[model samples]
Target: MKINAFADVSLRALLVLSSAPAGELLTTQNIADAVGTPYHHVSKAIVRLRELGLIDVERGRKGGSRLSQAGHKATVGQLLRELDTRSDPAECHSSHGDCPLIIECGLRGALARAREAFYRELDGVVVSSLPSFRQMAPVFQTIGLRPGM
Candidate 1:
């Protein structure tokens, strides 16, 4: 299944923050530049993350965003679940009006099981275990993103 850009950006942002010293604040634009995502999109994701209690935002001139206390402990699956509301991979009608094979098909159930397995695997990966920009320098370079950008 394909995860959306929002999930990618949010995860990248969290990973970037994880690499920094605890309490180090990163501005929305800084995260956008680092992750090579649109600034506005990062800003919106930041707000959503903040509301989810994964991040904390400070106000004013010296203010920026920092991860919440649980951020490090927050599993990638948790983050994805919070950020990805439409987690279902199967397309089925609630009233059984759209899908003719709702009663006979096992594909939806199989896909759901696969999706759950995928998330279970992702749950084993901690945010702190994510590769840093320095570690992924070659990849960043290949994609034209300068290290530490």
Candidate 2:
């Protein structure tokens, strides 16, 4: 049930962009710094997010990134599904063909159900739901993205 760093950074970047000043473009390096991720990692996440239509990027001297309309409405689960590469809840390690319980064991099904339940819970949470404008203002300020700028 552990989400990878890519998924975590994707959410953080989206949240950061969602809270940024209107029409203000944010650099990926700035975002990476803010989220404590590597430059290349954030860059890759940005590309993936754009490919998913959850974010928009502008190139050139004034190049930067921002959350798109889809991003604004995206649920936590939706983003995770898009960014998380892990498909199976549990790995089948019966390559040796020695395990007899592999075929009948309920562990895999149980894990899948558990993963579904986790996603279901996350579906109720919007990326922008928990951190209020009031809560985000100070954070934005710290990042030099002051309110009303």
Candidate 3:
């Protein structure tokens, strides 16, 4: 049940954005640095997040990104489901060829149910509440923002 790297980076970007002061917009590089991820990966995550309405981005010299109203209220399950773009929980086709069981396998159904259950367990978990401001302040400070800023 491992999520993909893109989904992981998107979550990390959200966590960093959620820690910022209200209305504060953070540059993609700043977020990348804060999360210890590469700038390009964070940039791609930011674009997808904005497309999904989870974050807002402005384009200009002073422009950056911030959590949208939707972002603040987003559940971990919701975002993960959206970010994890796999059509099937398991791939029936491999380099060897399609599985003979693909036509009649009950495993796919079971796996789908299991994946949904995993998401349901996280439905009550809000992304913004993952780490408190105090917990994130030190990381933000390393990126040049003040503790409460």
Q: Which candidate number would show the highest TM-score if scored against the true structure?
A: 3
Off by over 4 Å in 3: 147-149
Ranking by lDDT: 3, 2, 1
Itemize residue pairs with steric clashes in candidate 2.
none
**Cα lDDT for residue 79, model 1?**
78
Q: Evaluate all candidate structures by whole-model CA lDDT and list the values in order.
A: 0.74, 0.79, 0.89
- Candidate 2 local lDDT, 25-77, one digit each (tens): 89998788767789899998899989999888999999999878887788998
**Rank list by TM-score:** 3, 2, 1
Instruction: Give the per-residue Cα lDDT of candidate 3 at 52.
Output: 90
Candidate 1: give the clashing pairs: none
- Per-candidate TM equals 0.79, 0.85, 0.94
Per-residue lDDT of 71-143 in model 1, one digit per residue for the tens?
Answer: 7778887777677666346667655566777786889889888877877878878875676666656544544
Candidate 1 error regions (>4 Å):
93-97, 136-149
Q: Candidate 3 on 1-149: residue-level lDDT in tens?
A: 89899999999999989878888889999999999999999999999999999999998999999999999899999998998878778888678988888987899999999999999998899998896767788898899995343
